[model samples]
Target: MTESQRPRILIVENEPQASEILTRWLEAEGHECVLVSDVDEACQQLEQDGFSALLADIVIAEKSGIELVAKAKEHDPDVAIILVAPSEDHHKVIKLLKMGAYGSVMKPLDQDEVTITVAHAVERRRLLLDSRQTQQHVKEEIQARIARMGEREEHTILRLVWAAECRDEATGDHIRRIGLYSATLAEALGWDQQQVDDIRLAATMHDIGKIGIADGILLRAERLTSEEFAVLRRHTEMGARILAGSEVPMLQMARDIALCHHERWDGSGYSQGLAAEEIPESGRIVAIVDVYDALSHPRVYRPAHPEEEVTAIMADGRDKHFDPRIFDCFLEVKSKFQHIRKEVVPEGVPS
Candidate 1:
């Protein structure tokens, strides 16, 4: 449709005579108008149908005109809003402008004055709309680029995890199983899909820091001394350092998981000694899932623990090794955890 033919004015005034006068003046100026008498009706129309400008009265049926202006702006911030008030309503009108209104016109409205005011408001609204659209487009573009970059980073991190698994001669299933398990734990703990997926992607890369450890240390097939164990713990710190410096939420979250997943809930674990809520929620979540996955699988140092034993250990560790509320959620959906394991793991892999 032509720009001139666009719906340019919305009149939200309760007094029929007042609304009619303003509408007639705007129509005479060749602008389209949609007239509604109350804030509720005005907001509904504004949300459902787009408008370029708004002319509203300060008093509607149980609704303030200033409220209509605010709501209309929320629906379409670029829509010009010219509030109509009486001479006595000047204070209220000033308040409206402060609240993001475009302009104000006195009630004994002049047809010529109304026409000029609306034309100016419409132009301003057009500019605002254009600017907002451009900003939103730019934001979407940035997010899309970040997502692509995240995918590449995820692949690189996965390859690192695969390298560690390969050294142990373990199948790729180890990382895959841990990733899915962490996502399930996150979802049970009431995390959103983005957060759940972030944990899933991040958990798979948790052991990436182990690559920095010597193969002798990693594949020792025996317990390490206190000094050697200390050296091994630095992997968490190194992983955090490697994954740091990005503004991306997922990677930032991943870094936290790498750094703090070994931390005990009672402040007994880790390089930084972060305890409880000091740990990122994502990190706290992966801690439990990672340990559970390790125990349930046949690791280089230990045999696979039974599912029942795993659950008992988790329960025993609640509020010390894991977030208490998350542990509760895990217990509540314990059966579902097994189902996820069965779906994601083959018959040969320990559950």
Candidate 2:
């Protein structure tokens, strides 16, 4: 962040030395710090407004850190909380994180880890706020298009697409590619025109269940904790449930793609471990393109890899994460996929 945008951090630690250490570390990184020895001071400071994050001990002057976290969240749900605790308090840290703390820095803290964690927490806070603003803009635009499109089925599909795009990693460009790329692959596989058309629309809704995930978990800037990942993985099942029992052929295909897209060809995937041919053909097709689009785009944790690097990863996944025969077909139609990648508008830019 710029100097004008330095984070105003609230530090709640009872120990004088630890408090000083935190202040020095954070301030050296150009952050503005508010130091308090007890939860009461923290609460008072919190009431004054302008804290971008809360850095607190597991126990702050006889009060539980969890209380301060809750209070801070109430004040500003977007305020990132970084807990300071001993390794033995891993359970406490986990619970606090689940309660909306950004993350924790195990005590006897490593300077790099402390600084890095705080930086990441602060960045996440900013990104999530920015993303929410962007999503609102996107939603308004989507709603306008939906209103003009007319017809119940088209409206339902676009609304579901809106749900997926408004929340998670499904960018407008990403959604477009999923449909076109999946359709391209299906056509190359000698599928009938109807099959290709169904796969086109169905593939875009594969992650619609992401609407059910919390913004904090979905927008996290670092690797997720196991508990967090468990929560995230449920999007597949949730998507399936959302699309379930639709008598329409497209919705049925969508349900299958959502549920089984994450299942590995070698049986290492989740929600259910169907392997090889056991994974439905719909899931198999969407999985390859979903991964392709994801890897080709910049994500929260990493930048987008070049096409060659992305292709290498896909090649390595052959007969493992992807179906071998379909993989070969994708290679054959590689030029068409390249064209789709170029044709879509750049992600995060207004389209």
Candidate 3:
């Protein structure tokens, strides 16, 4: 990379006299030369060591020197190859160049011309290597920056979720359980790691729109009248609006979960009334987990239902309230769901 550094050259010539001449000329010019007689020796040297330029005679034993050019390239595509030969045919030279020979030197090699050509080829190789290293460094830096941005976005989302939880102390454990439950189901459903992680964080924000609802409706101990229930339903649309139009993948997933978590598989749920697969998979997944957690835990309007009763309630809604496949996956991992609920539910509180 530096001007003072000598270029390591691999000289492949069968004839001792020609090999000596090239070696002395290149060495005198301050380049380090490794002399090898045939293609086999050249390939061995190329594989064992790194070389900046390969200067090979056109005819090497029974094999053509053009073959060495390809072999050297295979060892290191950035290596420069110069063919030394007797033929002056333009077409032959073009063929060799197309085969990846950097340049050709005539049989009665002129010392000045050979030196200048090898010098140029070696310089070109050095530039290419430097450029590749620079590109790699830039790529690594970009990935690091993107990872940092993802971390920052996750932190911001968690803070907002916590702020929303402050509106109702009783719902704090509910939010945590929802995240764990969604992540576990997503993993069982064969979602990739990124999707599982995104859904975990995004699921926590499903009730974020409650922050915008008035305390009168959100904290009411009595069941809501039909007219008031409509206002409560608006929270879904409001949550979607709060999280919409983000470029972040997690936020986008959060928006979908927030908007459609209440939608039913039978097209009977509020807001969009999307049926079956018309709803985003994230929404469908959160819906089952949300309802299960709500039923298992005590709310102002009702006491916590027994686990048997909760299971029956969920089973009754199978195709009507939830996606069939998702409901099945939930059943398969229902035990894990119970474990997570017990682990995350706050102390002195019944789940």
Question: What is the TM-score of each predicted model, taking all chains together?
Answer: 0.55, 0.54, 0.78
Q: Could you give me the TM-score of model 3 versus the true structure? A: 0.78
Global lDDT for candidate 2?
0.84
lDDT tens digits, residue span 1-351, model 2: 111388889998888889889999999999999888888788888777767788889866225666787788887888888889999988878888887788888889789999999998888888877888889989999998876763455446655586566766566667767888999999999989988978878887888888889999988878899999999999999999999998989889999999999999999998799999989898999889989888888877689989899899899999999999999998889888888787654545323
lDDT of each: 0.77, 0.84, 0.85
Write down the lDDT that model 1 would get: 0.77
Query: In terms of lDDT, which candidate is strongest?
Result: 3
Model 3 gets an lDDT of 0.85
2-61 in candidate 1: lDDT tens per residue?
A: 235555688888787887787787787888888887778888988887787877786662
Q: List the residue pairs that clash in candidate 3.
A: none
Tell me the tens digit of each residue's lDDT in model 3 across 1-351: 333378899998978889899999999999999998888988999898888888877767226645677788888998888878786655666677888888878888889989999999888988998898899999999999999997787667666687676777545566767888999999999999999999988999998877788888877778898888888898899999999999989889999999999999999997899999999999999999999998998776679999999989999999999999999999999999899877665544222
> Positional deviation of 301 in candidate 3, in angstroms?
9.5
